[model samples]
Target: MSLMDYTDQWLSVVQPQISQGSSWLADLRQGAVEQFATQGLPHARLENWKYTDVKALAKREFVLPKNAATQADALVAETSLALDGIRLVFVNGLFSAAHSQLDALPKGANVLPLADNANVAKTLLGQVAAANFSGFTALNLAAWQDGVVIDLAANTVVEMPIYLQFVSTEHTDACLIQPRILIKAGVYAQATVVEHFAGAEEAANFTNVVTEVDLADGAQITHYKLQQESVHQYHIASLHVQQQRDSRFTSHNICLGGKLARQDIQVELNAEGAEVNLNGLYLGNGRQHLDNHTLVNHNAPHTNSNEDYKGILNDRSRGVFNGRVVVHKNAQKIEAHQSNGNLLLSDKAEIDTKPELEIYADDVKCSHGSTTGQLDENALFALRSRGLDEAMARGLLTLAFANEVIDRIEIPAVHDRIELAVAGRLPEKFNLKGLV
Candidate 1:
C-alpha cells in the first residue's frame, strides 16, 4: 500500500485521540497532520535523509498499543539501567505515574507529565521548534500521546540526574509509538538528563521520538541518550536544542540495538559565548543499520562547538555519520571542530561518513575529519604476542578505540553501563571486566 493510504487509515483511527486537546494544541496538531500529509515519509531523495531510507517503515501495518499499564511492571523491571536518579517512565509513549518517582526533586525543580497538565503543557510543547521539520517529526507532533516536561528555576542546580525511560511492551503485534520530551533550563541553572529507549527482544516495534531543549543565559546542561531497542525494531529520534548567551550544552549519544536506527541532533547557538560539545558512539552487528546526523549552527559571534562520533560495525552491518557545521556571515570569532571515526570488524561491513563545514565569517576556525578502516594488524599482533589470545586482543583493541569517546562521559554510572553494553557485543572470548 502507498504511504498516503496507510497514513489516511492510521489517521482515521487516531483522529479522535488527537481531538481532545485545547484549541491551540488542536490547531497545532491539525497543522502538523497537514504538513505530514503534504511531505509524507522521508526517502533517499531528501538530502538530509539520503543515507537512511525510511520508506521501509511504511510497509508495516502498525497499530496503537492496548492497555500499556498491564505490561508496565514487567517491562520496567526488565529494562532498568540501575543509575541513581529521579525516574520518569513511559509505557508505549504514555506517562505512567505508578512507575515514576518525582517526589524527591529539588524545591525549584518541576517534573510534570504532559497528560496531566494540558494547560501548562501547551505553553512549553514545541517551543524550540525544528528549523526544518521532517515528515516523521510532523507525524510525531500530530499523533503524540504523552511526554514529560522538565523545568528548572533560575540559579537552581539539580544535584542528581533525571532519567527518562521509554519502554515498549507490545510483543504480540506490530506497534507504533511517538514519545515527546521538553526541557527548559533557567538562567544559571545546571542539570543532567538521560533519555533511554528499550523494549522486548522479539517485538516488532516502531519508535519515533522528538526532544526539545531550551537553555537560558548561563545555564548548563549535560544530556545523554541511549538507544537499545529490539533488533527487530525500527527507531528514529530527533533532538533539537537552543542555547542562549554564555550557556553550555553537552550531549553523549549511544546507539546499540535496532534493525534500522537513525538519530538526528541539531544545535543552534543563538547568543554570544554559547558553547556545545557532542560525543556519540554506535555499535552495529549482523545486518543492522545505524545512522547519525548532526548539525551545529553558529549564529552568534564568539561561539564554540565540538563534535566527535565513532562507530563499530560487524558482520554486514552498515553505519553512517553526517556532521555539518555552519557559521553565519556575521558570526565571526567562532571555533568549531568535528570528527567521525569508524571501525569495521568484518570485511563485509560498510560505513559512509561525511564531515561538512560552511563558514561565512573570515575569523572563524573550523575543521572536520573522518576516517574508516579495519583494526590495526600491528596493534593486534603486538597484543597477541603478549599473553592475550587473538579474539581477546582484537576485542581489547576495539574497546580501546571506543574508549576515546566513552572516557569523555562525566557520569561514572553511565560510562560503566555503556562499557558493559559494548563488551556484551564483542567476541565471546573477550573479557572486558578489567579492561574498560
Candidate 2:
C-alpha cells in the first residue's frame, strides 16, 4: 500500500484517542491531522528529504503504545548521566511522576506536564513557525499525548541543568510514540536542558518527537540531545527555536543508535544581535542509517550563527548531512558559517553532505562547505611509525576526528558520556580509553 494509505489507516484507528482532549486542543489536533492527510510522509521527491526517504517507514504496521505499564526504573538507571539535576521521565511517551523529580524547582521556575496545563500549554504550543517541516511534524502534533513544559522568569539563572528522559520498552508488536516539549526562557534568563531518548536493545518501535523553544531578549539556553534507540527502532525528531534581540541559543546533538534515525533543527533569529550555535555528532555502524538536517534564518541585522556537524560511518552504514543558511533582505552585518565533515572507516560505508548558503544581503558574511573522505593515510602511517598497530592507529584517528565536535560540549558529564559511547562503537581490537 502507499504511504498515504498507511497514514490514513493509522489516523482512523487513533481518532478516538486524539478526540479525548479539550475542545481547543481537539480542534488544533484535527487541523494538524488534516494537514498531514494532505501531505503524507516526505519522500525522495522532496528537496529537503531528497537523501533520506520516509517511505520505508510505512512498510511496518505500528500501533499506538498500549496502556500496559513497563518497568522503566532499570532502564532509566542504565541510561542515567548521574548528574545532579531535576529529572522528568516518560515511559512509552507517557509522563511517569513516580520516576520524575518535579518538586522544589528554583524560585520563579515553572515545570509541569503539558496535559495537566493544557490551558497554558496551548498558548505556547505551535507558536514557533516551521514553514518547511514535513508531514511527520503534523502527525506528531496530532498524536502526541503528553510531554514537559518549562518556563523561567526574567533574570533567573538555573545553575543545575534539566534532564528530560524518554524510555521505550520492548513490545510484542511494533508500536509508535510521540513526545512533545516546550521551553520558554524569559528575558535575561539562562538555562540548560538535556533530552535523552533510549529504548530496549532489540525493540521494534517508532518514536516521533517535536520540541519548541522561545528565547526572549537577552535570554540564553544550551540544549543537548542524545539519541540511543535500539538498532531495530526508527526515530525522527524536529526542533524549532526562535530567538529575540540579544538572545543566544546553542544545540549539541549526539546520535549513537537506531536502524534509521533523522533529526531536523530549524532556528530563526528574529531580532538584532541574536546568536545561535549548533554542533552535532552521529556514529553509525552495521546497516544503520543516520541523517541530520539543519536550517538557520538570519532575519535581523547583527545576528550570527555557526554550525558544525561530524559523522563516522563504519560497516555498510550510511549518513547524510544537509545544512542551509538564509540571509534575508535588510538583515545585514550577519555572520554565518556552516561545515559538515565525515569520516568513513570502511570502503562500503557512505556519506552524503550538502551545505548551502542563500544570501540576499550583500553586506552579510555567509559561507558553507562539506567534506567526506576516509582516514588520512599520512596520519595513519605516522601513527604506525610511532609503534601503534594499524587498528589502534585508525581508532585513535577516528576518535580524534569525532572529538573535534565532542570537545565543544561544555558540560563535562555530557562530554564524558559521548566519549564513552563513541569508544564503545569502535572495534574491540582498539583500546580507546587511553586516547580519550
Candidate 3:
C-alpha cells in the first residue's frame, strides 16, 4: 500500500480519541496528509535530504501503541531521579496525566496537554515549524497523538525547573511514535526546562518530534534536550525558537542515542537586542549515525547569536554537522558566530562538518568555521607516559575534547548529567596507542 493509505489506517485507529476536534485542525491535517500522499518520503535527490535516506523509514509498517493494560503505578515509581519541580510524563508518545506531577507550579504557571487544549495547539502548531519538514514530520502533524502546552505568566519567575520525560515502550517490535510540545513565555518571564527522550530496549522504532517555542519581550528561557534510546531505534527532532525584543534564549541539544538520528533546529531573533546561544554534542559508536542541522536568523538590528557543536565518532559510526547563520539586510550591527568540530577515533569512522555564514547586511559581523580530524597524538602521548593505559589515554583526550563544549552549559546539574553520559560512551582505542 501507499504511504497515505497507511496514514489513513493510522488515523482510523485513533479516531475514538478525537475529542471536540477543531474544524480547522481537522482540515489542516487532511491537507497535510494529502501533501504527504502526493510526495512520498524525500529521497536522496532532494536537496535537504541529500545525505539521509527516508525510504528506509517508508518501508516499515508501524502501529499506534494500544492503551496501557499495565498499571501506570509501575511507570511513575520508576521515575526516581527526582528534580526540584514540576514533571510531565508521556508513554509511547501518549500523554499520561496520571503519571505527571505538577505540585510545585508557581501562581502563574500553567501546564496542560496540548491535544486537549485544541485552540492553543492549533494556534501554535504549524505556525513556526519548518514548512517543508521531512515526511516523518508530515505524518506527525497529520496524526499526532498528544502534546504538552506550557505557559508562563508575565513578570513571573518560576523558582523550580520543569522536567519532561518521554518514554518509548509497548512496541516490542517495529513501530513509530511522534511527540509534540509547544511553549510560550510571556513578557518579563523567566524559566528553565529539561526534556529527556529514552527508549525501553533495543527495538526497531522511530520517534518524530517537533517543538515550538515563543518568547515575548524581556523574557529569558533556558532549554535542554537529552536523547538516549536503543541502538536499534531511529530519532528525528525539530526545534523552532522565536525571540522578541530584549529576550534571552539559551538552548543545548545532547544526542547520545538511536541507530540513525537527525535533528533540525532553528532559532530566529525577531526583535532588537535579542540574544541566543545554541550548543550541541553528539556521541556515536558501533555503526550508528547522528546528524545535526541548525540555522540561526538575525532579522532585527543589534541581535547577537553564538553557536558551537562538537561530536566524537568511534568504531564504524558516522556523524554529520551543518550549521548556518543568516543576517538579513535590515539587521544592522548583528553579531553571529558558528563552529563545528569533530574527532574520529577509528580509521573506518567518518564525519562531515559544514559551517555556513550568509550575510546581506553590510554592518553585520558574522563568521563560521568547521574542522574534522582525529584526536591529537601529542596529547595522548603525554597522558600515556604518566602511567595511563592506551584506552584510558584516549578516553581522557576524548573527554577533554568534548568537555570544551559541555562547559558552556550554565546549568550545573544538567551539565553533570550530560558529562556522565558522554563518559559512558568512550573506551580505550588500542590502535592509537603507538601513534599517540
Candidate 4:
C-alpha cells in the first residue's frame, strides 16, 4: 500500500483516543491530524527527503497514551540529568511540574510549561507553532500535550546550564510521543541549554519533536541535542532558530538512536555581525539509518557562519548529510564555510554527503566540501604495531575521527559526557588507551 493509505490507517486506529487530550486542545489536534493525513510522510521523491526514506518508518501504528499519570516514576527519576541546573521533564509528551525543578534558576530566568504560562507564552507559542512545517511537526502541533518554555531577562547571565529531557517509557504497549519547546533569550543575555531524548526500553515506538529558539540583539545562546532511543523506534526532529542584530547562536546535534532518524536544523542571520556555528555527529550500525540536514542563511551584511558534520557507519548501516549555505544579494562581506566527512567501516555500509552553496552577492566568501571513504590502513597498521589489537586500534582511530567534531563543543563537562557516550557505542571488544 502507499504511504497515504498507511497514514490513514494509523489515524483511524488512534481516532478513538483523540479525546484524551485537554478539551481545549481537542479541536486543534483533530485539525492537525487531518492535515497530516492529507500531507502524508515525505518519500525519496520529495526534495527534502530525497536521501532518506521515511515512508517505510511511517507504516507502523503506534498507540497513544491512555492518560498522563502512567509512568510517573520514570519521568521523575530521569530528570536528574542536570543536577545543579534548571530542569524540565516531559513524560510521553505530557508536562509534569512535580518532576521538574527550577528553584536554583537565576533571578531573571524563568522556566515553566507552555500550558501553565499560557497567557504570556501563548502569543509566541502560537506564532512559532506554524502548520507549514513537515508532517511530523504538523502532527506534533495537533497533539502535543505540554512543553517547556524558557525566558532569559535582559543582561542576565545564567551560570548553571539548563537541561530539558523528554523521556518515554513504554507502558503495556507500543506508542508515540510528541514534544514541543520554545526558548527566548533577551537582549545581551547568555545561557546554555541541553536537550536529551531517550527511551527506557527497546520497543516499537515513535517520537516527533519540534524546538524553536529566538535570540535578541547581542544575545548568546548555546544549544545541544542528544538523541538515544530504542533501536526499533523511529525519531523525527526539527529545530528552527532566529538571530537578531549582533546576536550569536550555536547548535550541536548528536544522533545515536532509532532504526530510522532524521533531523533538520535551520538558522537565519537577520542582522550584521551575527555569528553561528553548527556541528553534528552520528553513529550507526546494523541496519540503522541516520540523516542530518542543515541550512544557514546570510540575509544581512557581514554575517559569518561555520559548519562541520561527520558520521561513522559500521555493519550495513547508512548515513546521510546535506549542508546548504545561502547568501542573499545584499549580504556582502559574508563569510561562510561548510564541510561533511564520513567513514564507512564496512563495504556494505553507505554514506551520502552533499554540500551546496548558493550565493547572490559579489563580495561574499562561501565554500563547501564533502568526503566519504573507509578507515586509513596506514594508521590502523601503526596502531597494531604499537601492541594494540585490531578492534582496539579501530576503536581508537574511530574516536579520534569523531574528535574533530567534538572539539567544536565549548562546554568541558558536556564534551566529556558526549565523548564517553560515543565511545561506548563502538565495538564491544575495542579498547582505548592513547585515544583521549
Off by over 4 Å in 3: 1-20, 69-81, 428-436
**3 against 4, candidate with superior lDDT:** 4
Report the error of model 4 at residue 113, Å. Answer: 1.7
Using lDDT as the measure, which candidate wins?
2
* Candidates sorted on lDDT, descending: 2, 1, 4, 3
lDDT of 4 by residue, 217-312 (tens): 999999988887767778899888888888998888989888899998888898998999998999998888998989888999999999989999
Model 2 CA RMSD to the hidden true structure, in angstroms: 1.7
Instruction: Predict model 1's lDDT versus the native.
Output: 0.85
lDDT of 3 by residue, 258-370 (tens): 98888988889999999999889999999888989898899999999999899999898889888888899889999998888888888888887778888999998887888
Candidate 3: C-alpha RMSD to true structure equals 3.6
Q: Given candidate 2, what's the lDDT at residue 397?
A: 88
Tens digit of per-residue lDDT, candidate 2, span 1-436: 5667777876875576578579998888888888888887887878988878777786677877765334777877787786676888888788888878876478978878777787778778888834237888888888787888889999988888888888888888887788889999999999999999887897778998899999999999999999988888899999999999999999999998888999999999999999999999999999999999999999999999999999999899999999989999999999999999998878999998889899999898877888886788999999999999998998988898889999998889989988888988876777776666
- Model 4's alpha-carbon lDDT is 0.79
The CA lDDT at 58 in model 1 is: 73
RMSD of 1: 1.8
Q: Whole-model lDDT for model 2 versus the true structure?
A: 0.87
Collision count of model 4:
0
Better of 1 and 2 by lDDT: 2
RMSD after CA superposition, every candidate: 1.8, 1.7, 3.6, 2.9
Question: Over all chains combined, what TM-score does candidate 2 have?
Answer: 0.96
